[model samples]
Target: MFLVLQLAIIVLSFIAHEHEAIAAYVPDYSSLVFPIHKHTDAAKPLYSVEIMTAYVNMQYLHANFLIDVDAPFIWHDCIVQWNIYPGSCPPDKLCTSPVSCDEYQCTDVRTSYSYQKPYCSPPKNESISPGWGYCSCSVNVVDPVTGSCGQAKLNYWDDFTVNVSNGKNVLTGVYGVYPYAACAPSSAFQSFPANVTGVMALSSSPYALPAHLLEPLENVIGLCLPSTLSTSGVLFYGNSPYYLLPQKDVDVRSYLSYTPLIKHPDSFGYFIDVNNIVIKKRSISIPANATTKISTLDPYAILRTDIYNRVIRRFSMVTKRIPPAKPVPPFGLCFSTQSGLRVPDIDFSLPEGKKWTMSAANSIKQVTKDVACLALVDGGATSEPAIVIGSFQMEDNFLVFDLENSTFGFSSSLLRKQTSCSNFNFTLVES
Candidate 1:
């Protein structure tokens, strides 16, 4: 759930100029070629994959981060838990580097009034007096698990060594070292899933992680979220190609269909042009230019009150014959598995006349052995962005946010294509 203040950024166009502009930044980038050398030649035969990529990987300007996760529905964005280096200096010896209150980065982050604010600050006299006063930069960080926003210190992260995966059953290396992240208080994490250190933000803001995709990488982020928790999903940065093992080395980028990415003058989130919605064969008409945006925070697809009621009501009617099960907490409608019935797929009709269908795997949630519910939620009437496509519906789908081209590309579902987002090599490969 988003604050009403940020929602105003979506509603009132004139008020946008009053705050720091969240422009869709475009960066010029050179083409990167990661060639898995088909052959190493007869004389100096080596690993079929190029050593150039391995050599170039360490010598590159900005390290490319390859993030993977098990549970996607409950977790959103690039989540990380940094392991502080042994010798990085910490002023207070707490192994933390707090940004100065007057630093430019602090000032810029302080202007993020919509999401974060100066929760606690000293008086003007003391804060400005370099000799007698000291104040740490404070900002708000959002917790996805509990949907709570809490005050956090904006600080520089002396990144720790982490594993980088270059496709399944192929390789692993300690390659990435990122800088800067919000440090949430330990109390804030009490409600979080155990061991979740921080959320590596992917929003389009200068202070976020996506801004680092400049030097050797393109302003492109490809995300493949897994459906089940048993396996892992992958994240790609820059111009890197995608290939899942056991299914031949096929780049999944070719399967994506493009849609124009809409720019919101006041927000750091990504928006898209969705014409309407279709359930089964019936079409549900929504306004053409509804404030529709995508989100990693929301647990399920949240529709504006009226729109949600219509969709869920219509769905119930179609399956009225099957007795409804006891009301689930988050889900409105559910039925017993004994009914031996199936749910309808929801189609998001885009402007290009192409519909992105959400199959049962994406639309329905199996809560218990006998209870399966329609995985949808109601965003009280007048919710900004009439439709917020949450992570639940994004599972197993490959999405590319091509910021440079102002386009959004999506692959409906990896399963239907005879693959999975959990392109994980579950079995022991003789690598």
Candidate 2:
């Protein structure tokens, strides 16, 4: 772990009843919450987005999903066959019904880059179920990394809860949000962690997870990614007043700096403007209109080859005095931590003179007891997205994505407040 950070555990109270309806048991006012867990994979990072969902084989499922802000629609690893099966719907799915091809929900898929129009099942095969045969919605489920896709059909999920927090000490689990729409892929292109199933999409698309869970409150997401596997991060699905407990007086939003979020017509990820990169007293000038995307799927921040070389060159010069350690596999540079080493913070200079500073904890990664390396990697060379901010740098940072106003808010590091993202109080309050 970079610095002192701890994320509270998000307890999931899943309802296993035969049929649970969300509309009957949900409160009008309350911010939905989830605890984010970092998995044990060191080679390729896998952050767990916990959930209980429904599909083909399983009656009930306790699954792990990736929190991908870059994806449009939510999809899972379930097999979907072309021909219709008589008894495909599980009991958990009985709470909600499948969407119809003639419905507006299916038409909305036409507007999405992540989905495809499902050819209406030839008139010969009478409709067995709403989404199965007659004009079902076919999809191209986007993988977070390669951008390649897998096949799936439009599906609705039930059994996901409607737990909410007061942004303080109380988190109450309402009945649940039934019929939340998602997709069922034939096979997930990306590898999963153990029981991992799919992605918790928080993209800008109207079909994302947040879109299905839209409430009467502010359209925003407050997220804190944890740095350590021993702890977990937190998510707030609504506007804030997101409080870090024990020190409830300190609201995480108070420290955020705002920047306009840029949208790509072809992509579903969030993009930001970066004037240049700065290290120590040296300022490395980048293209005037250079932009970068923040990704939860990328384990390490990636810079263009040229930009990465410049950063490593500058860093090497800055700490040239320290003894160098043996090179790690992916990391080009390493320093002997046993002899004591210090790294200068790297800054992604934003417009309006605002800088998204990367603290040493985020700037460097401790690969081994005596070895430490820069937490950045090279993404070949591309000007379209000169940088891709990764999960390693996002740990313990309270990020607020305001979709309503098209803005991105960030808290540099929660450790600076003497608390971590784990400070949220998930304990239930008695009515």
Candidate 3:
């Protein structure tokens, strides 16, 4: 018994030593702190500086900020409808035709370019309208719901309030107030007895209504940063320039000079860059295996979407073990398993009703997964295969990634501030 106890003591001693070693070598996670500050640049007009934190795994960023969904507030008393299955091709419109004449399987294409759509015969193909009906999903933009819908809609505004978890004190009196006439038609409106939760005024100076982070799918009345200042360009619907003014302080009459930024305008996708914002691109180095094809990748570029041709999160960690030997995915190829890197985008449609209810259908869901980042094991020999990560839904926009415990986080670089800050670059190895 004495011998056994002695042996146990020796094992315990070793474990203690290991723990101490780990404590010493574990990267000071505190060093990874994100810097959020109040900006008072009237020329730039930025009221806040939301500095994104750097992480070993980019997934954390996506799960926390990018993939966030904003629930539309109840446009009190507003009545809205959507057209889900706006049927087939219209008359005078040419449909796809397969051509055997081409060496490869080819789809013969015709559009306004190839065929001039003539006036259709009355009552012909009446089921097919000249234009697709706009899809409308109910938004709780003012009085929000318990959960936002996931399925896509052509037109909708999800009511969302910023969740100031870590630093509510910084935004002492921030308040979110929209013009009553903003959502006119009045029939489709909703009013929640509760006031906006994350509302605050950077300063109670009462310049006008402060700009809210416009919902991705909403018809943005205006953008309110602390001011018009932008470190990076503000993204909008049509990639067109839009004016930024405090919503509370400005008048809609002045907006007549500038075109309102429309979401999903007659076309599908486009990018909007705000004026005066200096957007810098961040380049992170990824590892290439011995057989990695460097030529296939844009060696200097960092966008996973641009290089890999898919929406994904990139992670780089320094592990004690070599990454499992595998063929990195081919550049510009989509993953078959529907997994690679996933960058989260805001889905403002999630429901967050009156209470802190988790059971609601639109409750915040935090989705996370163990994703792989670009690595350079042997200076470009092979690429890594996509891994199936996990996801979770949270009640608010803030996401937590516990890298110290080995689980990872996810995020996209889309909303990150571009900078010459090289600390954003990383290298991976076995822990």
Candidate 4:
């Protein structure tokens, strides 16, 4: 079920009223924090970053900022129906394939292009008509739902600024917004304004540094996503203390754990070294020289059925001491407990003797009052065979992606503590 949810990407947008620039961005000792909220309607424990857009009306949008290591630029949903110019085409005539424009009685308007070109002024002698100029070039937009690609008319917002605040300190950055077909359900769409910035595309966009991270200004950022529904977390720029526990905060610079971030040349997904799995103190044997691949720490933990089977087999072996109940349809291992049962701890052994242990709360799910099912799911036969540590496993942990240093850090979150994260001080140590 989690795997299916990962494939169904639904893009969303929001509208806000326009506002004046607060003040020049100052990098002082003060930190800017944005509250992370959970989408209750989402199938999985999805998180969103609340941001303000500098559209005509000053709209607010929730940007889904994934810890995607491979993304090159930030992406956002723009207003396609507005009928705006996309700038002039390149000298090479590398515009997207031309589409029919009845108003101009011409089919030369390219609807999609390999990359968005810089906005250029129309030639003085050039005649302008509705959808008849070089500015009509299109952009390649991906449908979050079906993973299909289509063309959406392009328009550029020179004053586009996304405002991120934690009620005290606010941070803002500019972004290029592009419109795509609404992928969210109709009911959800009605809740948002008719004209809103649906998405704040970040990570990988054609930029030397990620613009969303206040690129060229502040290169460091940290994310602490809470796993529980009752609590909220913080996403901040620059360095601060390790958010080990909300109630008991620790300086990340003082005692933070470090791991080398493995890079995949062809992808933007963050990958890490995982040696083996240990269930109930017993190390499960993996095939020798099995070409262990780095599993992406994605929002969804998707394990290939083959690997899921191996992990479950070892899990079953350790739990053989308990009475087995009927197995759940989707989940392979499940049990019926009256007084509750003790599920063994599962650990993923990393290099340098470092181990990430999964607590029972993260490894088990209460499907019913009497029946509990394993939270892990099969990736099916065709899914990526590599292991993916999804958001479920990352709950209750402060995940820091230090792009400036090219490293990743993880520590326990301040569980259930609700406080302004801006007040906390963090040490900015460049890796």
- TM-score of every model? 0.72, 0.81, 0.19, 0.64
lDDT of 3: 0.21
Write the residue-wise lDDT of candidate 1 on 215-276 in tens digits: 44568777766665445565655655666655657777878888988877667778888887
Better model by lDDT: candidate 1 vs candidate 4: 1
Best first by lDDT, ranked = 2, 1, 4, 3
Candidate 2 residues 317-344, lDDT tens each? 9989989988796788889998787778
| Per-residue lDDT over 146-186 for candidate 3, one digit per residue giving the tens place of the 0 to 100 score | 22211111113322222111111112121122321112132
Q: Compared to the true structure, candidate 3 yields what TM-score?
A: 0.19
Error of 3 at 307 (Å): 5.9
Model 3 spans > 4 angstroms off? 1-371, 374-431
- Model 4 CA deviation exceeding 4 Å by range: 1-26, 29-31, 55-72, 80-132, 135-137, 143-150, 153-209, 212-218, 242-249, 252-255, 285-300, 322-325, 412-431
Candidate 2 lDDT: 0.72
| Shift of residue 286 alpha carbon in model 2, Å | 1.7
Evaluate all candidate structures by whole-model CA lDDT and list the values in order. Answer: 0.60, 0.72, 0.21, 0.47
Ranking by TM-score: 2, 1, 4, 3
